[model samples]
Target: MRERRTIIDAGWILLLLIWSVTILFPLIWVFYESLRTNQEFFQDVWKLPSELKWSNYRKAWEAYGIGRAMLNTVYYVGASLAIGTFLTAINAYVLTRLEFRGRKLVWGLIMLSLFLPGINALVPQYILMRDLHLTNSLTGLVILDSLSESAFYLMMLAGFIQSLPKELEESASIDGASIFQTFFRIIMPLSTAGIVTVAIFKFLGLYNSFLGPFIYLSDPKKYTIGVAMYQANMIMQYKTDWVTLFAGLVITMVPLVLMYIFLQRSIMEGATMGAVKG
Candidate 1:
């Protein structure tokens, strides 16, 4: 039995190492390729550059407009994450904590939305944006992203909120705290783990969103990083500047990698807390 358990543990460790390599190898290759000149990259796809071409990053930023696109992405992502997280938290709180007529029905509808294909809503959403004269604008994109509720965040937050003790709320009420006060001061603070988790997820979604920005914003100046990446790829088709394209890709990946590196622990904890009943 001891030998069998040892063998199983070794197998799991080996599998994990393979998984890690698969994920890391592409990122490593991309970064290395970004430092090479187009001639070197095309001549030997697998060989390291004899001399690093740092100018590739500068060209990507200046010529390809990655800098401007990055700033635009920050605005869109920031606005959407701030508004979306607040609304999702409040919605989850109300659904889990408060009692009212048709509450269960609302919950059921939200659950039903989870199973529905999001692509089905694209036409209606586009029409609505067009009617509002919001298409081809950053504000329009923010409105669209902020308004769409994530059932996953709602459910996670609701689960976390459900696990909280009711006595804290009751105590606040006895102390003359209004529902709003209790939510903002007491509940919100206690639910930080869940809120941060949801916010991170929202940030990633908005940061990486390509389709929405691609369809909604007609102006090149308003393009987000995702769209910018696509545009860079298109330019490469004609120019064959693969090194600059790789640099642009690396720049786009940096924020996401940094965010995950810093917040991975919190994300894991929040997920665990939400899953387990208190």
Candidate 2:
């Protein structure tokens, strides 16, 4: 049994090593490619860059309007992430804590929506947004996403809220704390790990969201990072500036990488933890 366990552990470690290389190689390759001039890239696609042409990043930023698109992404992603996470937390709190009629039914509906592919609502959502004159406006995108319901995250946060001790609520109420006060001051604070986990997930989703932004936002100034990257791809067909495109992608990816690196410990630790105390 000991020998078998050792073999299994070794195999797992080997697999993980391979997986890490598989993921890291492309990012390293792209960083090198971004530093190469178009001439050097064509000369040898895999060769080390003789000189790092940092100007590629500048050109990509100015020519592709990635700077503007990045700012737009900041607004679009920030507003949506904040509103969505708060609303999700509130919904989770209510669903788990407050007793009401048809609660199970509402939860069931949410579960049903979770199973439903979001693509099914694509056409109708576009029509609604277009009719409301929301298309091509970043503010419109913010409003639309902020109000949109996501049942998946609802369930994620609900589990954490539900795991919390009822005694906390009881203790707050005994001190004459109102429901809102108990929730905001006690529940919200206790559910910090879970809330942070949810916020991180929401931020990642909002940052990478492509189709909705592409379909609704028509103006160049309003383009998110995803849409701007797509536009860069379109430009590549006409003018093959691969190095600059790679630089833009590298720029887009660095922040996300840093964010995940900083919060990775939280994600791992938060998943199994709750506010419960003995």
Candidate 3:
């Protein structure tokens, strides 16, 4: 049994290493390329840099106006994560814990949209945003993103809620706790794993979103990091400054990488809870 377990662990490690290489190689290459000068990048795309160019980020940051763009990105992401996660938790709680006449139908409708291509709604969305004067505004992007709650995330939280013993809520009610109070004090605290999982997901989604900001934010200063990266890369057409572009890409990815590292435990637990319960 010991030998069998060791072999299984070794196999898993090998699989993980392979997966990491597949995902990380391109990023590593990009970082390495960011150190190369324009001429070096053009001449030796695959070769190591002769010197580390720490100044690449400074040039990229100034050219991209990434400071203001990053600030805008932060506002967009922070608003979306805060609003989306709250609404999702509330929606999940209602669907799983509360009784309603058309609960099943409501859930069914949400589920049906799961298979629909999100791009199909872009035209209508753009029109609506234009009509509402939400275009070219950060608030508009946040509001739009917040409204489109992820069905999968809601389902994950709902599953976690369902798995918890109802007696906890019952006990709270016996102590004269109102529904809101019970949710805030009892359910929300106990469902931290699920909520944290959903928050991390929404954070990642908002952080990396390209389409929403790309379509809505016409102002360059209001652009997100993703859009800024696109702009930086586009400048390469005229300037051939590939190093700056790579540096911009690295900056764009850093927040996401740091967030994942910080919340990985909660994310794993929440994901596993949903899978196990459902």
Best by lDDT: 1
For model 3, the superposed segments whose C-alpha errors exceed 4 Å read 1-12
Residue 110 C-alpha lDDT in model 2 = 86
Candidate 3 residues 146-224, lDDT tens each? 9987888988889888888999999988999998998888878988888898898788778878988999988997898
- Model 2, runs deviating above 4 Å: 274-278
In candidate 1, how many Å is residue 134 off? 0.6
Give the per-residue Cα lDDT of candidate 3 at 90: 86
Can you give the TM-score per candidate against the true fold?
Answer: 0.98, 0.95, 0.93
Candidate 3 pairs with clashing backbones: none
lDDT of 2: 0.89
Worst 10 residues of 2 by lDDT: 269-278
> lDDT for model 3, on a 0 to 1 scale?
0.88
**Model 1 global lDDT (CA atoms, 0 to 1):** 0.92
Measured with C-alpha atoms, the lDDT of residue 102 in candidate 3 is 99
Q: Model 1 compared with the native: what TM-score? A: 0.98
Compose the digit string of candidate 1's lDDT tens values, residues 1-278: 99999999999999999999999999999999999988988899899789998888998999879889989998999999999899999999999999999999999999999999999999999999999999999998999999899898899899999989999999999999999999999999999998998898889889989999999999999999999899888887679889889998998899999999999999999888877853
Report the lDDT tens digits of candidate 2 across residue range 1-278.
99999999999999999999999999999998999999999899988888989999999899889889989999999999888889889988999999999999998898889778989998998999989998999888888888887887777788888888899999999999998999999989998988888888888889999998999998888899999999998988888789999999999998799998998999777765633321
Ranking by TM-score: 1, 2, 3
Q: Is candidate 1 or candidate 3 better by lDDT?
A: 1
